[model samples]
Target chain A: MWLLKLAWKNMWRNRNRTAITIAAVFFSVILSILTNSLQDGIFDNLIKNVVSFYNGYIQVHKQGYWDEQILDNTFEGTSALEDSILALENVNALAPRLESFALASSDTLTKGCLVIGISPEKENSITELKNKLKEGEYLNEQDFGALIAEGLAKRLKLYLHDTLVIIGQGYHGAMAVGKYPIKGILKFGSPDLNDQMLYLSLPAAQELYGAPKMLTSYVVGLENPSNLDPTAEILRDKLGNEYEAMTWEEMMPEVVQHIRTDKGSLVIIQGVLYMLIGFGIIGTLLMMMVERKYEMGMLVAIGMKKRKLMQLMLIESVFTVLSGCILGMLASIPIVFYLNRYPIKFKGELAEVYEEFGFEAIFPTSTNPEIFLTQGLFVICMALLLSLYPIVKIARLDPVAAMKK
Target chain B: MNTVIDAHQVSKTFNPTTIPILAVNNVHLHLERGEFTALVGPSGSGKTTLLNLLGGLDKPDKGSIFINGVDITKLSPNALIDFRLNNIGFVFQSFNLIPVLTARENVELIMQLQHKDRREINERVETLFREIGLEDKLDTRPAQLSGGQQQRVAVARALASKPQFVLADEPTANLDSKSATNLLDIMAKLNQEENITFIFSTHDVRVIERARRVITLVDGQIHSDTAKVSTEVPHTAQKRTP
Candidate 1:
């Protein structure tokens, strides 16, 4: 233990060298923490927007309906489907929705849109579509009321009280048309959705589309988002071939794939950055060893054993790494916390690019505390691993050659 | 008398890139317990090489080397390290005290490797530091002390281990005239009072005059062995004797 203290003191003998080495480690640690925390936060926000807006962790639809999603491919005669699924242990909320496209017209203007029919209470419960109303009330449960996207409302020159005409093909081979007063102008984040989606009462939708008793797929919710697979399986067995239980996974396959690829690439990037940091530390340690070679030889000449010399080298490395790592970790906390609270915003072209793809432009680092702990551990551990090369080199050092220099 | 160090025809060769040179050729020497022996030779006469062979830091190419009756030449590298740690102390021309360690910690370094209790190491180091008249310099690092003080710390370190022999190679080469004399006097006194054998290789006249016995080497061989008759000391009351 005393020998180790001597080794630690030896490293600090060259003050500027020790400080430079520590600074390198400290900067690397800070960069790693920032990059990782931001990556985690961005990925999480994308997932939350997709899941909370429409797909409720998992979704349930008829088999093959996921791929086709046409009105004719929905669950037709699964009368016991809802009751059977609700019996599951973790099933929280489920809402059946009918989705289709139509051309909306306001006398002089015409635009294509995705028109959706939903049970007012159930849709309200799942997506809080009711709270998304910017200008008017939610679609009335007992009466015919419709929610139109802000972009769609603009093109049609439709106000909250203005009537708009929607035309499309019904469940069968017949034309469906309807004129309804716009109850609300809803903004559902993504500009694409803001330009295309319209929500109407389920009964009004069935009457207009000529699919009276027929409906569309269900959007299911679970107690915990992580338990999506198990809940989806039970629903699949109960509904059989008449329906398929599709989780958020199938709905947002591209999003999930993006997250996986992003994580893999970030790991490689952080790994390379840390490798560079390790090399910097190794360079410093090697320099220290070279400078102290004669002194080390003298120590052994004055009765220090090779084993004790090796211990001293290791102790020096540990001290250097620990000081930097602890300082770096301490410094990261407030910076990450402040960034998490107040996100970064991009305007103009960058904003438009994200909006075009149905994403938020402003990014916030995740508030998850694991971001700090996990990154801190990774940086500290890599630094320690880098320390090994110096110790090994010292252990194999020849005291005689050391003294000659 | 018990022989503290014994070597028979010890030869050391350094394998350079293109040629192997024999540094210490066919040399044999022994130091009895409590005796001060000087192995004197000019530079490149292989005095330090022979010292290394005796200290087990380097191996003889073609001969057996023993310390306190044990054939250290046959020991493995790790065993040789343990051997040196337990049975031998070294003082170098440069003093070789660790620059980062205080005077007492420098003395305690070997005993630390021996894994002695902290209390025992402290007491022994303290005793040795006091004997060297550096009790106030116990907390001073080698770099902080003068050349003479550094040598005194080295002597204390050598004595702290209580080894059977100390191998000193030009120990006072870096000190001033007074420091060299004072250090030699302490070492001579310690050799007499403690009965610890000290073997040195030097070109210094003061060391030669103070040494009880001297062995001269040249061209990789011992050229002469002589006993000195000191003109300075009174023979009647030699309180400390080897």
Candidate 2:
């Protein structure tokens, strides 16, 4: 206890030095926490927008359908299988899609586009397709009219109630042709998706493709998409060998790869930041140890053991680091919360670039407690590591020689 | 007389490879209990080195040092540290009190290291402070104390754990003449009243005059040893310096 008292008093012996050291630790801690919080916030937002909005967190398809997504690979889904999947925990809704490519033609233009057939109610619940309508009404199960994205409609020069022709190869090389009135025009955040997507009711698509009661994939929504892996595993186990249950990471490895690459770069940045902080702390400790050399020698020569002196020094450092970390955390809370509430929004070409990639150009800060705790622990661990220099120095100190200085 | 410290032909060398300088060479010395001894020599004559060896602050390259009949050279580093904590005390030339600690706390530190009972430590610190005429400055830090008061506090601290002996290296070297006279008076009184053994290294004539026995060192060997004739002097013989 007296050791602690001595350490506390010793720390204040040079008030300016102590304050400068503490300020270095404080600012570094805040920078680390805020940087991590903002990165996590942006990643979370990206995942929510790109994966959950359209791709679903997980999906189920025929074992070979993902590799060859043609009309022939479509499966006849049984109601019993769907009911079993719905019974699983966190499974919110499933939209079965029969997807293929076709040539879409009107009076002025002809373009290659992806044709998707979906159940109106299930698709609406999963992708919120109804909210994306730019014109006309949403498709019903009984309605045979198709819903096309606004970009595709503009290219084809078609309006609501106009007849558009879709021609393609059906299952087993069968010829597929259809003329359907446009029931609705939808807009998409991604220009790629907007220019190439057309949706029809499942039965109408099955009829046009000369295949009845077939589905290419089941896009599964969840109550909590963050628990994607475990849910995917459970689904895989339940679905057996005929079907493959894959999470968004597996189904769309491109986005996962992009995020992983970004994270790797961020980790390098964080490493550099920590190195700078470590060097700052080391510089301060070096100054302190150098200044206290004579005092330490005197203490050791007076029958106070070197180990005791080392303990006092360590206690003093921990007091400094713990105080700095706690204060830095406290100081960062309001800034993080405020940034979270009012994110920095981007405009002009930057906003267009973000929209091209299906993201909004706003930078938000995360309010997750784990971010602060992890950053605080990292700084403290750094302090502990840097403290080894002094401990080793004291351990090998020659008191008789030290007193001469 | 019981010998409290025995150094058998102790030798220490510095910069052995390049300079090969012998700081203390083949010196033999013994100190009895209750003796106030001074090691006197010119600069670089090995007085401080000899004091360091006797206090177990440095190990001699040759020969063994014995305190209370136990050979200290054979003790491990950790054991030597424990031994020093229990048996040895030191007073540095600069009155090296921990600048952060108060006068009372400085005196209490050695007793705390000994794990003495709290009430006992407090009582002893109080008595020692009162004895040193520092009762009024118990809570004053070293920076706030005068040179004489700080030296008195250092003395109180050295005696706090009741060690077998105290080694002071040039204790009065940094003090003004008045503080030096007052410090010598306090240490002399403590030595006579408590029968505490004290060994100090000094070039100061004042400290040498006050010591009961003086051993002069020249070029790393003891040149002369003399015991002063007994003279009756009052406890307050040296006038106080404020």
Candidate 3:
């Protein structure tokens, strides 16, 4: 108890030095936390945007269908299968799609395009497809017309209400052909999707492809996207061997690879930041040791044990470091949350660059409690590690020589 | 008479490997209980070196020192520190009181290190402060106290743990003539009334004059050990010198 009092008093003996040390730790913590929060936030937002724009959080396909996406790999769409999937806890909604490539033509132009068949209202609920409609009316259950991507319509020189022709091979080498009025022109954030997508109502597409009651894939919406992997696993197990449920991370390895590479770079940056924090703490501790040499010699001469003196120094360091870390965390709470609420938007070329990659051009911060705890604990450990210098100095000190100094 | 300290063939060398300098060479001494003694010499004559050897602050390159019948030279470093805490007190030339602590806290520090009971520590500190005539300066830190008052507090601290003896190295060198005389008078009174042993290494004539026995060192050897008849009696009734 007496040692504690002495340590506390000693820490404040030089207020300016102590305050400078604490401020260094304080600003380091805030910078580290904000950097981590922003990195995680940007990646999370990218995943959310990619998943919601077209593919739902998880997809269920017939066995071997993802590997060979042809009309032959399509499975019969069953209401019982949909009911059983929707019964799961995290499964919010499901949309069944029949998709294949066809050659599209109008008047004097022709282009290769992807034709998708969807149940209008169910697909709208999952992907919010109606919101992307830029011209003409959206598809209905009875409508025989199709929705063409704006870029695809421009390539074919077709307009809304114009007649369009599609020709492709059907299931079992059968001939498949269709002619329909373009009911809507849809715009997509991704240029690749906008250039080649043509959407048809479920029954109309089933008839045109001569594969009635078949679906290529089932898009599963989730209540909590973070539970996507586990939910997909549960659905896969429940559906048995005939189907395979895969999360977006499994289906889109390119996106996952991008995020992983970015995270690796961030780790290196964080390492550099922690190193600077360590040096700052070490500098302060070095100054303290030099200043207190004479006093320490006197204490040792007066029969204070070296072990006790080391303990006193450690307690003083802990007081300084813990106070700085706690204050930094408290100060960062509102700033991180404010950034999360109102993200920083990019302007001009940066905004265009983000859109080019089919992503929103804003940076938000994550409010994960783990980021705060991990960063705070790591810095505290670093400061404590550097405090070993004083203990070693005291252990080897010669009282007579120190007093002379 | 109880032998409070005994030094047998004590010697210390500053740099034995290259250009060696012998600080204290083959010295022998014994201190009895309640003796007021001064180890006096010119500069670089090994008075302070011998005092450090006796106080267990440094170990001799050769020979053994016994305090209260235990040979301290044979003890381990940690054990030496514990032994010093229980049996020896120290006062430095600079009045090296811990600057962060108040005068009362400084005086209470040694007793606390000895793990004395709370009430006993308080009572002893109060008595020592009164004896040193600095009862009113209890709460003042070392920086706020005059040189005389600070040295008196150092004396009180040295006696707080009831050690077998006190070792002071040039304790009055930094004080004025009046402060040095008052400090010597207080130490002399403590020796006379409580039989507390004090051994100082100093060149000050005032301290040497008040000491009952004076041991003079020349070239790391004892030149004279004289027990003179006391002329100046310890005047406890004198007013506190500020």
Instruction: List the pairs of residues colliding in candidate 2.
Output: none
Instruction: Compose the digit string of candidate 3's lDDT tens values, residues A1-405.
Output: 998999899989999989998898899999999999999889877775677667788888898887888899989989999999999999989999888999999998999999999999999988889988999999998679999999899999999999999999887778889999999999875666788889999998898899999998899989988887789889989999999888888888888998999999999999999999998899999999899899898888888899999999999999999888988888888989999999988989989887777677888999998888888998899889999999999999888888994
Which should have the higher lDDT, number 1 or number 2? Answer: 2
Distance from true position, residue A352, model 3, in Å? Answer: 2.4
Looking only at chain B, model 3 earns a TM-score of: 0.93
- Which DockQ-derived CAPRI band holds candidate 1? medium
Q: Give the alpha carbon lDDT tens digit for every residue of B1-242 in model 2.
A: 48899889899999998989899999989899998988877789999999988888899999999999989999887788778878887888889898989999999998998889999998999899888889999999999999888998999998898889999988998899999998888888888998889998987778878888877777898877777622222121232210
Docking class of 3: medium
DockQ in order: 0.50, 0.63, 0.66
Fnat by candidate, in order: 0.46, 0.68, 0.71
Worst lDDT run of 10 residues, candidate 2 chain A, spans: A45-54
Winner by TM-score? 1
Candidate with maximal lDDT = 3
Task: Evaluate candidate 2 and give its CAPRI docking class based on DockQ.
Answer: medium
